[model samples]
Target chain A: MNKKTPKSYENMLEVKNLKTYFLTDAGIVKAVDGISFSLRQGETLGIVGESGCGKSVTNLSIMRLIPSPPGKIVDGQIIFEGTDILALPENELRNIRGNKISMVFQDPMTSLNPFLRISTQMIETIRIHQDISKKEALAKSIEMLKLVGIPAAEERIFNYPHQFSGGMRQRVMIAMALSCEAKILIADEPTTALDVTIQAQILELIQKLSKKLNTSVILITHDLGVVAGMCENVCVMYAGKIVEKAKTDDLYKQPAHPYTFGLIQSVPRLDKAKDGKLFSIEGQPPNVIDLPPCCPFHPRCHKVMDICRNQYPPTVDLGNSHEVSCWLYAEHKELADA
Target chain B: MTKYIIRRLLGIIPTLLIIITLSFFIVRVAPGGPFDTEKKLPEVVMRNIEAKYHLDEPLVVQYGRYMFDVLRGDLGPSFRYKDHDVNFYIFQSLPNSMILGVIAISISIIFGISSGMLAAVKQNTWVDYLSMALAVVGISVPLFVIAPVLQYVFAMQLGWLPTSGWFTNGDGWQTILLPAVTLAFADFATIARLTRSSMLDTLRSDYIRTAKAKGMRSSSIIFKHAMKGSMLPIVSYLGPAFAGIITGSVVVEQVFRIPGLGKFFVQSSFNRDYTLIVGVVIVYSVILVIMNFIVDVVYSLLDPRITYK
Candidate 1:
């Protein structure tokens, strides 16, 4: 679909101040509160955060898959291929979904329809976007199954999802998502449910496929190790907001936001076995509903400042595309707790 | 699936035997005998009547003789019906009941599933409330009340349909409509309620969300992806309900004055017509067994996870 645009299109996708909220009987939950990020044409972006930090909601908002009544995208612009998808009509949005952008969910055990054969699911996904014959769709489905390294793609394609193992099912999902050659693939914790060994293989397969197809990937996971290995750009989110953003190497080498530093410190390394006790960030993440207008991490940060309690710190640019949000990086703030 | 069906068929023999044996003994245990009347007959004449039918013999001998006759497809003669045998009467009325039941079930299924699905899809809307409200009314009102109200409205007031009886007047299907609808209304309500909850559960499943994420049309998602999963409960219900309807509805047949199995069933029990009572029970048992067998086959078809050995 980007064929209509110039070949030199820089950013494939851009999200600006996306605020997704869930209005419950208790209160309005700011699941994703005013966050922005962008993905380059072929670059993989990582969104790493604790559970309930709106990592999934941010991507779901892009797809407009969040259940309404409870969930509403209060404000946002999800610009894909120079057009804002959030503002597009449903028919236009449908043309973008699975045609230009595809999504892979977390669990494979329950994601695929148990009654439908792998062939049926795969063929439908292929045929929906492309005006292809059923025979061509079947052949393309077989090709995709083979491409995903599924053994005996010819025979296994006709079998039901229950006949396949969990890892194999996830592979089938990836194959179906990419069958239409979607430009962007949003994988939300795709390997979180797999075994440790299988996770590496799945991630490797994703990396290899994206490189081959030139598909920009937005990987959402809580694992820093996964981001370090696959993503060129990483955004660390905390309490529904991006606390820091930078090149993967720069963020790891020179962590700026206190929350980001605390997350890095929390990762247990096998190479560093001389630790007395593993580092852990004290205190739970703040409740997102009716959250205060200040840094959410202030209660847990060791370098807590008096100003951090009153006003939210502005994002500070630290060169080479590194950005952080913390009172420690603010130049105008007085030394309230020197 | 064929193997499973064959096994289920074989399993029906012992079940039918039990039903036949129980009904045979139960009818004899009732208060009056087939020949009993308000006016007493001469002792010699009573003895001759009993002797002719083998009732003068021991109860075990009569049971053995009855079983033997049943094996040869002879249900014996009805005492109260005079010349007609139990088999003859059943053959005559069963078709009428079957025709009424088939029409009723079809109508129930079409309306029930559609209304139920609509309610689930448009939950919290007026469409949901209205359909469910009608379903509740259908269930809460007994068949006797519902049957009469329909007869009065469609037959009496509207003058568009007949009030009762079948094949007596010049009218054909118009006579069958009132009773068929009466039978269907109650069953329709049950099916609708069951389907709504089932569809709601299916809609919330992960696969449904996956279908939506795939950018499937709403119709395709509901019909193609969600339909079969929700049908499990409804299929199981239709089994027994099918057998009951086909066997006959006592109230429906009586109210409409149609000649059906249920009418004979009620009459035979009242007059101590042992042979007729046992015959009707046998038909119900066989149909129930077959219907359950059908349910199992459909379950395997709808759900791939269920397999036949």
Candidate 2:
């Protein structure tokens, strides 16, 4: 067990060797398999993956929000501010959930209770963690609405969720998430359900607010473009495992893992030739329930080798905090040893 | 909102008029007359009886006369009772039936809601299975069977309560209990099933997940968040269920020997008391319409997304 924190020692949250699985009647589905990452205070980490690649599951496990019976955190350690959140009692965990660590979900249309007024929802959230009267909490809610650039915040606060548009509802969601001055916020594809124009506005709001509040953020999305624009560091996930991780600029400059390279190439770029066709990775992501014995991506890897079919590749550091799991890296390791 | 309520109220007038017209003709069209008896009277005596009540008038004229009298707050003479008019008999018997109905509905709501919520919260478990199984029994068995079974158990065998009759003094509650419980069981089953299914759906809603993510206590999430959303179906069910209970109380009233409107309604129908039957039908229809109107109002209250407009 590596119990040591990195020497920099300013991490706000650390997820260590987290393994979340679902016990379906068919079989066990390994949704999150031994993923680890550290978030420095005020840092933004983007987890980029295709759909069903465990990006959302990882974030849910961090918040301990996975539904049981089918979904369970098989093993994990979520250390938030040096406390093991999984080990905390439910009552104590409640304090950390929406207070220290808040979350914004994918669909703003369904996230807010349609029966309740926006002001009531916001004020209740405020009062849940803070010792404040309804009037004070209401004032705070209006202030949050104003902060999120909702026009006529005072009047709009009295309106229900159905009355708000998609972008405006998302703004309300963000306002609620930030109302408690949380130290960390997990946004699970927060702008996926909105228009392209509104997506930019929401992304800007999240980035600007995180910077202002100095709140660490874990932004999970499938869009690499979103990661490129917003994240400082990015982790590329495939088949419930992190295959490549690097500083965003370095990742864009020279992706080491085959999967990461394929992802980068797949994006249609303005700099590329107008007549050239866009690149796409062939083959589907591996089945999580019955993954191949060796490297999970070997079946789809363009750079596959005999070793990739025989055994799982170990994660190798490629210097400058960039790491990748691939037999190509293992060949480098063997050469270095020789 | 006021306009909506006014519109709903106005809609009931035509509805009641239709109900009154239909019931009036149907009762008259039936073969027996209110004056008929086992021992046949002389033809002249029968003619005088028919003329006294204006029964000899044409059907349309009779209906028009009845409507006019009703507009003046007159539910005409009860042939079976002879001394009291239909209005006097109904008003006298209504309070007992109302008390019984209110008690039965209250019992159903309290127990039904709790059991339903429990079943939903403990879904696919013994609690859910048992409550649903009980609900199936309640629905499958008729209230007539339930009334007798309850009478036998609580009244005959246990001897804890009186077997039949309404005591107007202090012990009136005891007399109503067996009948009320009998009436409540079927509605309880209906309400429980409706609530369980609706609550299960509400609990699974994304907003419930949001509530959980907000770190709300489980009780608050269930009651404050899920309960209100779940109530829309139950509220809608209550309007019809209330009317069903009142009309369906006939057998229970007979079984318990309670002098409620249901008993009088049954006797009037048997004795061919035209005015009394018509009077009861009109009252029941009005109650049904008003109950449904109230349900719509409550529906809007529970769900801010719903507007009458």
Candidate 3:
């Protein structure tokens, strides 16, 4: 724990004021408003929010994976290892996507090609970004399957996606993602579609593998518990903005923003004995197209003020690497007393 | 799997019976007899001809006798052509139509699928628009219209090749080219349009996005991922289309002066060659049935989730 501080930070990725918008027939949707963050080597960052909060959109913008016409990363600078990835040619970006930065999608069943065998899909992925003989590719693929904890890798490799259960398909997706030993992994709700037990096993596998490889991870999810368990740094998003960010322990202990506070309170804690009462955030998220002029959450925010109704709050720092955007924390010293 | 197949096979029985029964009665009901054009043959000769085909008796008896002949694979002799058995004439002309149909359909499938894939991969680009536009033009303009236009431009004006015939002295491809091109035009358009639309739908699938996320080359994604996934719809359209081509279209044969099955079918109908017409209908029906079976098998192979059983 002490080794984490003052660690010589070799910056792996720096994203500055990224903005991705979708120009739909209804109107322009600011899916990801201006947001900035940086990740150093061997770090795990958890991004948590409700759906439509831009957690997934942020990662998609980084990868330049958004479909155009309907989607576009309008303004952003994604400086990955000194090069602006947003400006790179598509071919170069293709090489970096699987080799340097890999992503595992939400639904494992549909993510895999139904027509192809597990071995075929895995081996083809390995060969695409690397030059290796068929025999070597096959061997590496089997090793990867085993690496993800599938027993009898050789025999199972030939089986189709349907032959495997849902949990196993997620394992297959993870295996494909890790085949290249990628430096950065982007897992978007990786375990959301799996059963609770399988989700835990998958989470554990990811944590162990990341530690072993010293790889960085961007865990995108709505499950606060998973984020609290796995991520070191946490970012809370609301209506496309990073409303709060802090060290995991600090964020849990001192949730600065109302949304974050609400999220932590909403999780069912056995220790609380709160009975059948589940804390529900009142109202729904704001419409992206015609959002209010001030804070998007003002209508639902319990701490709404005259200023909060007309003005968006700037981020206020709360030391120990914690920051949040909410009018309640506007007074720097007064906030400390509370 | 076997149960499903047996069900599909049994399903065809009722379909074929209806087609044969309806066509036999319908042809008989039409305005003329096979000997209508001749000088009203002597009563005895006419009665003998009708008796030979069981047409001298009641409609039910004639229908029963015709069905029996069909079961025996005996199409009977032609009324107008005289002594030329309907089955033999059909077999002789069928190969010609089959060759034309095969060549045309092959070109359509290859070009249609390839171009459709390209359009899907490069969506909203000029390639997508151009290919779609070409398909639209292909569909709107009938083959008869395109055939003469193409013939005029390439053959009459360009003089790059011979105009028509299954062959000059029945040698090789020199003669079959024009007729085949004419017959294939509409099918090529339909295939291209179907392939393009189906591929576009496939490209939007979650697996395709996963493939792209897997860091695959765009070409591999288009061919291996998109093309293979969208093939079921294309395959479904193929069975009937192929049968249509093989059975032949009369307009194309007339325009190109190729004496294929289409020409025979039309001539038999015109002359009220009842035995020959009946034979042609039966042959066409069999082709349709067989093609449909092959299509079902191909569909099952492409998507394991499909089960006829």
lDDT leader: 1
Name the candidate, 1 or 3, with the larger DockQ value: 1
TM-score of chain A of 2: 0.95
Write down the TM-score of model 3's second chain.
Answer: 0.91
True contacts kept of each: 0.59, 0.62, 0.60
The whole-model lDDT of each prediction reads: 0.90, 0.89, 0.84
- Among residues 3 or more apart in sequence or in different chains, the pairs in candidate 2 whose N, CA or C atoms overlap within 3 Å are none
Off by over 4 Å in 3: A1-9, A270-275, A290-292, A331-338, B1-18, B29-32, B35-48, B168-172, B270-272, B304-309
- The C-alpha interface RMSD of every prediction is 0.9, 0.9, 1.3
DockQ-based class of model 1: medium
Q: What are the models' TM-scores?
A: 0.93, 0.91, 0.92
B1-309 per-residue lDDT for model 1 (tens digits): 678778888999998888999999988887889889999989999999899889999999999999999989999998788878999999989988998999999999999999999999998899999999999998999999999899899989999998987974445768888999999998899999999999999998988877877778888999989998999999999999999998889899889988888888888888898898999888888899899989999999999999998
Given candidate 2, what's the lDDT at residue B107? 90
Report the lDDT tens digits of candidate 3 across residue range B46-131: 88877876677988977887788878888878887876788889988888788888988887788877777777777889998998
lDDT by residue (tens digit), candidate 2, B68-183: 99889898988778787999988887787888888898899898999999999999999999999989988899988888888889988999998888877455568988888888
Candidate 1 wrongly placed segments (more than 4 Å): A1-8, A272-277, A333-338, B26-59, B168-170
